[model samples]
Target: MLFENQRVTPSVSGAGEFMKAALEGAEAIVLAQSSMEELVKVHKICRRRPGMKLLLHLDSMKGLSKTPEAVSFLAGYIKPDALITSSPQAAVEARRHGITSVLRCFAFDEESIDSSLKLIERANPDYVQVVPGVIPVTIRLMRAKTGLPVLAGGLVRTDADVCRAEKAGATGITSSCPDLWQAAYVSRAKRS
Candidate 1:
C-alpha cells in the first residue's frame, strides 16, 4: 500500500513519540523497541487517528516472539497495518496472515547487500526497508535489484537525508526525530 503522499513515517518506540508523531500528522508510524504492555495503549492512540498506518517492528519489540504464532496474535489482536521484520519466515507469515510485510535489511557492505537480496527472494515481502538510509547508492541498488518499494530507515536524521533518499528512489523514509516529521509534513504541504 502507498503511504498516501506522506514521505516521512515516524519511527516511534514510546508513548511520547507516538503522541508527538500523531499530533504532527504522520500518516504512518513504525512502532519499535516497545513492550507487549505498551501495544494496546499505542494501538488505542493510533486508532484515534483516522487512516493512520501502524507498522510494528517485530525484531526489536520486547516480549514478542518472532514466530508465526506471534504473527497470528499481532494480526488478530493488535491489527496493525503492516509488520516489519528481519526474519524471512516471519515476513512470509505476516503476508500469510493478510498483513503487509516489510523486510528490514542492513546494507552496510556488498556482502550484506547480497545477503539482503537473498532474504528478499526468500520473504517476497510487500516492501523492503533498507537501514542507514544515508547511503543513496545502496538505496538505488536495492530498488534496482528488488523492484519492491523501499522505505529508508536508520540514521535518517535530517531533511537533507530525506531528500537524498527520495532522490535515490526511496518510496518513503522512517525517522525517529519529531522535527523531521514536522519538516516533512511542511515540505509536502508546500509542494501541494
Candidate 2:
C-alpha cells in the first residue's frame, strides 16, 4: 500500500507488530504523534527503517490537538513526509513548512464527503484517508467524483476487505492485517 496509518502504541508488544508486520511492504506510514515524547519515539523507530516514509499525524486521540506546540515540536525532531489532521488551519500551516498535508475527514458522510471534495479541490492535498464504515455508500460515490487517490481505512481485517475497497474506487487499503498482505503475496506467487 502507498500509505498506512499507525497509531503509536505505548505497549512494546504492539510496536513490535507494527515494525515487523505493517512496515514490510508499505511505501509510507503515518504515526500518531499523541505527545511530544511519543512523537520522538515513533520518529526514532520509523527513521531507523530504510525505504519507509513517515508522516506525523496530529490526532486528538490523546488530547494533542489543543496544543499548538505539537507541530513545531515535532518539526524540530524530524521532517515528516506529511501531517494528518481534521483541522483546516493546521493543514494550511503544515504546507508552509514544505511538508505534504493530508486532511483526514475520519468518516464518510454527506457533509464530510462534500467537505472532503471541497478540501481536496482547495488545498490539493497529497492524498486523503476516509473510513468507509462511516458511510459505505459515500465511498463508492466519492470514488467516482474525485481523481485523487483514495485510501480505505478503519477496521479493515480481511483480504475481501482490501479487494472490496479497491473495487469501490480506492487505490488500495491501509490495514494492520499481515494476512491480507500475505494473501497478496501468495496470489502473486500463484500467478508466477
Candidate 3:
C-alpha cells in the first residue's frame, strides 16, 4: 500500500521497492495508487506476491476526487476486498452496494469530524480509519459510534505513533513513510 507522499512514477526498481516496502511487514496492506491504471498494476503484483494481505484503497491522490470513472475503475480492477474513501456518503453508498468498505475520516476540524461520524454511523463500514490529524478521543468515539474497526492514518512518521494509536484503540495505521511497517511489525511482535 502507498501513502500520500510515496512516489508513483513507473520504474522497475522503484516499483519493486515500493511493493517490498509496502508489503514486507504489513499484516494487511492498503495500496493508495495515484491512478486507476496504477491501481490495477499494483493489484496484479499483489496477487502475485506472497504473504502480505491486500486491501485496495481508492485514495484519489493524483486523480479526480470522486467520479463515476474513478468508482468504476476501482470496482472493476482487482475486485477489491475493501474500499477506502474520505467521504461518508461514498462509504455509505459503497456499503449499501455490498462491498467490504473502509472509510478514512479525514477530519481536519470539528465539523468534518462530526460529518464523518454521522457518515460512519450511518453506513457502518467494516473499518473506519482516522487520519494522523485525528485525536485519540475522536477515534474512540468514531469506533463507539460506528462499531467498526478503526485504522489511523496521515503523518504517521514513527513507530511510537502506531503503538500509541493502537493502544488508544486503532486497529491499524496508514502512512507513506517507509519505516512504519518494520516498526509496527516489531511493536506487534513485542506485544504478542
Whole-model lDDT values for every prediction: 0.86, 0.55, 0.58
* Clash pairs, model 2 backbone: none
* Cα lDDT tens digits for candidate 1, 41-86: 8998878878777889999899998898899999998998999999
In terms of lDDT, which candidate is strongest? 1
Question: Candidate 3, residues 1-192: lDDT per residue as tens digits?
Answer: 222122111111224544765544444556665555565566676687664344556655455455435555555655555667876656665665555677777766689778887777766777777875236776776677677777777766655665566667776666666665453352345453
Q: Candidate 1, 161: how far from true, in Å?
A: 0.7
Candidate 3 C-alpha error for residue 74, in Å: 2.6
lDDT of 2 by residue, 1-192 (tens): 234232211111234444654444444555553555555665677778765566666664354562336556546667777777666666666776666776666554578678777876666666566764234455677667766666666677755665566567665455544564443422323211
TM-score of 2: 0.71
Pairs that clash in candidate 1: none
How do all models score by TM-score? 0.94, 0.71, 0.74
Q: Residue 40 in model 1: shift from native, Å? A: 1.1
- Identify the candidate with maximal TM-score: 1
10 residues in a row with least lDDT, candidate 3: 4-13
